[model samples]
Target: MSPPHAVIAGAGIGGLCSALCLARAGWRVSLYEKAKILEESGAGLQLSPNACAVLRKLGVLERLTPFALAPQAIRIRRARDGATLALMPLNDAEARWGAPYLVVHRADLQRALLDAVAHEGRISLQTDAAVTGFAYGSDGVAVAISRGASRLEATGDCLIGADGLRSFVRQKLSPDDLNFSGRTAWRAVVEADRVPAAMRSEETTLWLGRKAHLVHYPLRQGTIINVVAIVDEDFQPDTDNFWSSHGASKFLEARFSRWDKSARDLLSAAPEWRKWPLADRAPAARLVSGRVALLGDAAHPMLPFLAQGAAQAIEDAGVLAEVLARGQDVEASFRAYQEIRLPRVTRVQKESRRQAVIYHLGGPAAFLRDAAMRALGGETMLARYDWLYRVRESPGQK
Candidate 1:
């Protein structure tokens, strides 16, 4: 008998990782990417120990290490005075969580996953292929693929929708609204020569303020720093355009005018800036429906506050692959994967939302929040997330 086959939609971190996991589990995998050319966007991502372990298990960690930055700590401070509040130690993260924390450019990680997928014989990848919809038949699940003006069909024992936030596959499964929080985020990367020596430390730094927060961390071995500034504001999205070249400097200049010179200088040094509204969906009790199921952003689009958006998706891929390897009915496998995953992702989503609130506390609330953070100290703060980082998974079963 032939090995079971799986069809994956989208080729982002989650999709590519899912394809690799399924193929490694003795399943023939077909991955469909909507983009004609898979270019790495200029953005950086944080890989906590939990996500790094999964990547290591999939055999992509070594390829990623060359581009990864292992920060020693995360420094939390006040945006106005730049006074250090607490330092979350990350140097010993590997010893504690069983894998090291890493930061890398989004493109580098994608390249590594794409390279691994290319070498795997069981996985066939198709670019310019968008999964429009899917249907379940007696033999298997049939998926509609749209390529330019033509539409084609592909069949597999099961279909996995790893497509990102604006997934067409998700809309087909159920109408889950992407709620835009009254907040907007600005992101930019500044080269090492442009940043001051003090700001380019081998640690992640966060500046908290009134109704806004700033986070910057080293990338490319400190040659560049990825900066993100998020502020609470009302926005009406064009619905057509998810991102635009807005005047990030102007917006940040006025909002963070009162912040310390260090923060202002970093903002000014960025050559260019881009803006996007933060959005998330309400947690759904059921992430699986029949032979078609969801994974990654399509399944749970959480806020970036927790830095677990990608990590949760990577975890989803690992669990989904393991569950499917059980040799159960296709529908049962998907249901099992969802049952094991939904609770954890939902909790992370809630925590991410809560962090957004805490990071942007105003006036008296902000003061008390800082006081609590200082009193709790960095080690305790990191300990609070032990449940998240200590998760261990094996391919045998859930």
Candidate 2:
């Protein structure tokens, strides 16, 4: 009997990782990317040990190491005075989680995934092919794709939408329920050499202030530093129209000007900046519909406070591949995928929302929050995150 064929939409991290996993599991996988050319254009991303372990299992970790930085700690501070509130040690991350935490340029990670997908002979990646629509039935799932004036259709035993938050496949599945999270995020990368020597450190630093917070970490072996500033605001300009959009540095500086000198210096050095209006959907009543299923941001889009957006998506790929490769019934495998992923992703989503509030507290509330952090101590704060960093795919499952 022939291995089942899988069709994947959107060739971002999730989609490409899905293709890598499925193809390695002996399934014939085809990935469609709407962009004319494959280019990794994001600022940077942090991959906790949990994410690293999954990628290691998929044989892409070693190739990505050159582009990654393994920070020794994560420090949260008061934005007004740069006083440390909580410091979580990450030096022993690999020993605890079975893989090292990684900070890499977003483009570098994408390149690694794309490279692995290309090397997997069972995977067919079609760039410039945009998935226009999909139809599912008991027999199978069929997808319509377009590239300029030409259009094509393909059929597979199952379909996975890893198309991200604005997924067309998701629109087909649940059109009316998408909800915005009432937040906006600004991101930029500054060369580490440009930052003052005293400010350059091998640690992830976070500054929590009223109505906004900033996170910074070294990527590319300290050659560059990635900064993400998130603010809770009344109005967020719609950035959903374009996948990559540039934002004004002056605007970002004005918003964060009152922050500590270190943060202001870092922001001032940023050469490019982009804005993303954060949004999400409630956990779907069901992530699977007939032969069609959703994965990654399409299935769950969460706030980045927890930094689990990509990690959860990577986890979804690993679990889904294992279930399908075991030769289980297709419907059962789809059901298992949803069952295993929904609860965890939902919890992460809610926790991320909660963190947003804690990070943006003001005056008396902010003092209380910091006092609690000090009382808990850095070790305790690190302990609180064990549940997040320790999750891994069951070894005996496959």
Best of the candidates, lDDT: 1
lDDT of 2 by residue, 136-167 (tens): 88778889999889999999999999998888
The ten-residue window of minimal lDDT in model 1 covers 389-398
Q: Give the whole-model CA lDDT for all candidates, comma-separated.
A: 0.88, 0.85
Positional deviation of 159 in candidate 2, in angstroms?
A: 0.3
Give all TM-scores, in the order shown. Answer: 0.97, 0.96
Candidate that would win on TM-score: 1
Per residue, candidate 1 scores C-alpha lDDT tens digits across 206-261 of: 99999999999999988999999989988887677665556557878999999999
- Where in model 1 is the C-alpha error above 4 Å? 395-398
Which stretches of candidate 2 lie above 4 Å from their native place? 239-244, 393-398
RMSD per prediction, one decimal?
1.4, 1.9
